[model samples]
Target: MSHAFLKIYNNKRNKNFFYKKQIIYIKNIIQLLIIICIMHNFWMEWNNFKKNKNISISHIIINGKKHYSNDEYIKKTISKILTTNNFFKLNLTIIKQHIKLIPWIQKIKIHKYWPNILKIYLTEYEPYAKWNENSFINKNGDIFILPKIYLEKTVNLTFFGPLNSQLKILTMYHTMQNELKKYNFFIYSIRMSRRESWQLILTNTIELKIGTKDIKKRLNRFIKIYPILKKKNKKHIKYIDLRYTNGVAVG
Candidate 1:
């Protein structure tokens, strides 16, 4: 009788343990379901907020303008549609793309001030170097092909290179400027070679051949020798080869 009673007691304990486990598992499942429902509700609310286009763009903000006349037309166009409400849809990539049509704008940030206002911030591109055949390049390497009228109004450095040659050309131009500061010689234009070497043309039409490596020492050598050579040679030399480890060879 004692052994049979003990067996029954052990079975009850085992069943209670399983019951407790099941209760805990159900509680966890309920918590997960509640969290999922809350997330779904939040997503739905966000969708409604995007669809609420009743509030139109009350104002347009512009920053970093070099010349006002060139960008006035762009601002006028934006102002026309600026009053239209409900443009910010859930997948409204079309409206976002239309903002880039502004000629002088380099980048834009779109946001909502809420209740009754929309805000747009635009950053205008400044010319870093002159592109080939009448264009301009920004500091970020973006090329802007505008009318010749814009070019005539401003002076920028001429930079020329093939598709893969931009990095090398930009580096060489900067290096030349740094070394030639003592001689007051700044590079007017940079032309790249097929072999990846750089040919720098200075203000006085002085041509310099800078190889792919050892730029500083080569330029320093030229700076030391250029004044002395210029005084001796009354005739304008064609080119100066600074690639040599010894003294520069002038022709």
Candidate 2:
């Protein structure tokens, strides 16, 4: 009976040892998996860092311009700037805002190419007309002042009033010019009335009072009578009133 008890105790001890060994092996495997995962993450992070560090600027491109600026000048100007972080993130809106903030740069687009290239495109404001010498207006009627360099050379039409007023007057003047081409009459200047009516100063020194509404009909009627008046050698007519529907009054 004593020998049998000793044999059973030994068998129980061996079983406990084997169970402990199994637990240790599993723990080791789990540790190894965690280490491998950490190493993989580190490797990925290192590769990304290297790629970012290798980024470079390949070409400095510029577009949408006239005789205003070139790529080399723009590149030089931008290179002098100390903001590289903003370039990498490459927010289009932010880039546009920054470019427009510059006096000569009206609108712009800055683009980034991965693995080290950047491109820049720009839209320069072409001043077409001058409004009272203080501000110059572009083709779209956007008002801006001229740079010191361009102030001397920009031959712009003389205009008056606020931006909205000037734009309206310009549009009307251009329309009238286009329509009156057949009559060989060109408008020198156009003034807007307080009630939004229009008064035109013709190239022949004739003043015309065009009412606020029905301008097309009024202009057509005036064109019909213009040749007759010119044939009668009437050069000093003060004002032609085309506001009336049935008749035109000329002074």
TM-score of each: 0.60, 0.53
Q: Which tens-of-lDDT digit does each residue in 1-251 have in candidate 1?
A: 99999999999999999999999999999999999999999999888777764656554444444452344565565554555544443222433466677565667666656544555556767777886647777766777655567786665578887775655666767777887876798887888767767777788788888786787788887888888998999999778998887978788
* Backbone clashes in model 1, listed as residue pairs: 53-86
Clashing pairs in 2: 56-116
Model 1 weakest lDDT span, ten residues long? 86-95
Candidate 2 lDDT over 151-229, as tens digits, reads: 6577534555543687787787788878887788877556776578877777777888888998878888889997787
Q: After the best TM-score superposition of candidate 2, give how far the Cα of residue 158 lies from its true spot, in angstroms.
A: 5.3
Candidate lDDT (C-alpha), each: 0.71, 0.71
Q: Give candidate 1's TM-score.
A: 0.60
For residue 39, model 2's alpha carbon misses the true position, in angstroms, by 17
lDDT of 1: 0.71
